[model samples]
Target: MALLWWEIFIVVFFVLAVLLPAAVIAFKPQWVFFSRGAKKSNAETINLVRTFMTHYSLPLGMDPLHRQLCLAFMDPFVKTVYSLFAILPDPWMVAICRAVDAFPGNTLRYILHAIIGRTHLIDHVVTEGIKRAGLGRCQWVLLGAGYDNRTYRMAPLRQAYQVATFEVDQEPLQQDKLRRLRKCAAVPPSAYEDVKYVTCNFNTERVQDVLLSANYQPGKRTIFLLEGVSMYLTKEGFAQTLAAIKELCPDDCTLTFDYVDERVINAYNGRTDIVDPPTPPLGSPRSVESTTLDEGMSDCEEGAMVVDKKTAASKKEEVASRASTPLTAEERRYGVQYCSVLERNQTPVTFGLDPSRLETQMAEHGYEIVQHWSPDELAQQFLKWPGGKESKHGGEIVSRACTYFYYCTVRPVRGSAV
Candidate 1:
């Protein structure tokens, strides 16, 4: 049987496209991308990239899907090829990639941290907070957990087998992730015996019901970790969610989460590669739901919105009134929602309040803020980078930017006098 010219060309292309890359990965692996030190010190880097790409793609935002697809395709290839050199064991490499495929947005965030050598900073801070809350032996809840491996990786938690961990998120999303994880990194169920998966939509799930179902007790010292999620929620939605936490947790419970400031959100508005709501109407008050730090004000009292209403209004008016707009294809596709994208295409909406305000709100609701880490302090801690400083992004490094606020709180024991 003689092959036609087109058939011959197709065969050649297929061989080069698929088989060649595989062969290179299996054989001459050292030629693969990434340094040996990087693979060892930051295995989660690739996973972060995968997570970021997944979030960017799954919601069908303004960014070209093709760009995300290309990164997804390239990521596994890099990991596979790199692992053949034994810098990173095959199992670990596969596990990282699988986790990335499981939660792309989070994976990408981790990858960025890895690149910047700041993953340890986050891990350290959270670990300290958890320990300080006296949750070393208590149950831990990871909200929107999304393939986080901390339950297994954090040394203290691993040593305390009495500690039960529950990972909560949407069921379908987790199931799909589990399938991919099984295909790539097939760890035995025994590895996760202390961890349980609770599938629930954050928007609809009854918090009390879910916690009870997960064997959570109200009087126990519990820690809730909410990272990179606040911006996606509406003001009411975010506040109601926190109120539920306060209601369910005992007096010793601690909650830690991050949120962007209004200024950062405004700066990021209309940028491609993000998911945000339409630019809010001019002079619109920042949501009262957020927490801010005001030196002269009592906790919970409203402070100035991080972004001045006049300023935001003027920018919106300018964008709206433009005769020849230069919005990107993604901005056009996603419309106003694209404004939500923050640094590197992640969501950047701030709920409009600061840490002090949140502390005040929590106090009223029976929770008291114990510690607050401002962006300046975090920047000083993380950005020192051994001997010297690195270039700044928009003169607002992650450590110094007013983009996020993190706090720890403990609920008062019932019947205790204020």
Candidate 2:
């Protein structure tokens, strides 16, 4: 009995030895801070994976090159985990992908591609936009580029059309990704040599000036992809970037980006998820409800009653607004988890735009909307097996995530636009 007990104890110890750290990584990310401090890299933790859709979407016949790029950029120690997993049958990868898809991100979209094939749908949109921009006549710029391999991945289109490709990002991160690409891919130098890398710190630098300094031709029609970037920037920063793009590109140039709804911004700030309704200007007639309340009150009571009625109507409006928008720290309980790891790392999500006002907002920057894709629409179009069968659990996942974000394209216009 003693010998049997010892064997069981040893088995349990080994199991925990293997699983405890993994659990810490997945659940207790604060451990990263206590142990070694936040990772010093400016690159977003989700950057590689955001573009690495191909890795998990392998079963769906997605491009495999981005997956290779992701594996290359991973830490050697982390890469070993994937290397070991590679020993399993391919189904394991598909299962992992599905797990990520099913794990709801709520409003913290900085983590997973919760809707599935989101990046790919953006890729498809950009590609189509480039076609419309006219082959060899337009320039393609990727803003806030993070290990983005679109320039290399779209090699055939680039080479055939003589597409002028530029990837703009912070200097250090741009260097890091290039170095990783060199080490990871065994392909010829031509694979990545042609693309220009323009670097800037969005807070302090002008993107338009840098692009021009880097020989970016403003006269050419430009298709700019600013993926996973806006939410990290302040509203002023994003607006300046937009203004710069408008300044740098001529009319009909394209800009593609995704932004979460305002509630996502509130989620990060721990603010009430309720966005106050568009109130009529102060002293605007509070007519119907106020008149109805006055009819029931005596002159002595009328004054106090009117005050109460106004307060009640205000409360009513607030409640009505909050009906669709959930409290951040409460709702799905994601508020507590709202990318807390990213918050500690100093890269917390900070910005979001109201979708209803998006086109009107872009119009302020001399751009007009060309197209938009909600998360559900993207899933409907791309979340299918190559054999044309819709994947399981796609609908519920995407519909819920829909309230979180949108993929939109806007093009520069000559004068005012709406």
Candidate 3:
């Protein structure tokens, strides 16, 4: 049988996305972190690619950014190619997005599992929040904004962007993004006139203080998008930031963030008790015989071959159970390797929370859940389910990091607004 295009694409994706990075981390521990496509921090680069998909014809609808930001972030040559796509009419761009989306077990869904889910969840929150609070009276903040261009897209100069938009991130990252924006020929110097950037280190200064310094008013409804930041933060750092959100506004704010289960944190910390199936490295053989079956297991196999029909049927059932249950171990391996990559880069994951205890944890911080999406829900809601055996193999390789992850939008329990 010949390989399909999607299958070939998957192979390439695994090599560039998985194996290459793993080799780097394994050989170059305690070194700088980056992939072949990276220019700055690996986190920002990856998030930029992921969130940039908001322009694609996603099921939740497209949230487009300025074309120059998109082009400026890419390599000079890649930016030229991206510009070709960016310059296309909306219908053509939509067609291109749909084409990529239709590929079976598409790379977009597998790689973007939790991200797409987070996008959908936050869009809902924003739309609803705008309705209730009125757009002009609300604030929108992107915490740890790393290459995020939402503020740029929603700046009042671009449209009737009534809500105040603020972006908060580390100083170096914000500086780099600003540099790129100013240097891009397609973007005007005044492109960032409307968005306020808050350069912050959450460990020392509180979020409320920094946002206030940036002219973020308290008591009005706010939507804080804390994306892909918690796991990198220490538990104490995460809690302190959460407390700041509470202090910023009461009852009226919507906070969206995601976290991994403690087992993921355990994996990062080199705990062995997780007991995931021993998945082989990408492209490695599935199994190898240590001893000739003819020498040792031949007699057992020959003996078992004479089993009654009932016994053979029982064996078949066991194999079937392996497929439908326990989900997969490959994703778990991906999750572990991801942690390994960051850990080697000296930015190990330190904070995680069990999804079941999410509401409880938020309650302790004076918040209540508005919506929560587990990994299973995210897969079903965002990615395409497998149709048959072929896609089942790809689906089995669904990123385990996504499985451990959980997303939610929560609101304060009481009004601190008055």
TM-score of each: 0.51, 0.74, 0.64
Q: Write the per-residue lDDT of candidate 1 for residues 247-297, one digit (tens) a residue.
A: 776455556665543323443453345333344445774432332222322
lDDT of each: 0.44, 0.59, 0.57
Tens-digit lDDT string for candidate 3 (1-418):
2568889997887666544533443344223224343324554445434433545443443444444565555545434333445545655644444443333333222334456556555555555555555537678888888776555554543235377878898887788888878877765555576678998887677888889999998877687888878888888888888888888876467788877666656765777765434445556643321111122212321111123445434433332232123324555555565576666556676788755456567767776665565566555444543344675333332222255666766667674331
Which runs in model 3 stand beyond 4 Å of their true positions?
Answer: 1-40, 51-68, 75-109, 156-161, 185-191, 272-328, 383-401, 415-418
How much does each candidate deviate from the true structure in C-alpha RMSD? 13.9, 12.8, 16.3
RMSD of 2: 12.8
Error of 3 at 311 (Å): 44
Q: For model 2, what is the error of residue 239's alpha carbon versus the real structure, in angstroms, after optimal superposition?
A: 1.0
In Å, residue 137's CA in model 1 sits off its true spot by 3.7
True-structure lDDT of candidate 2: 0.59
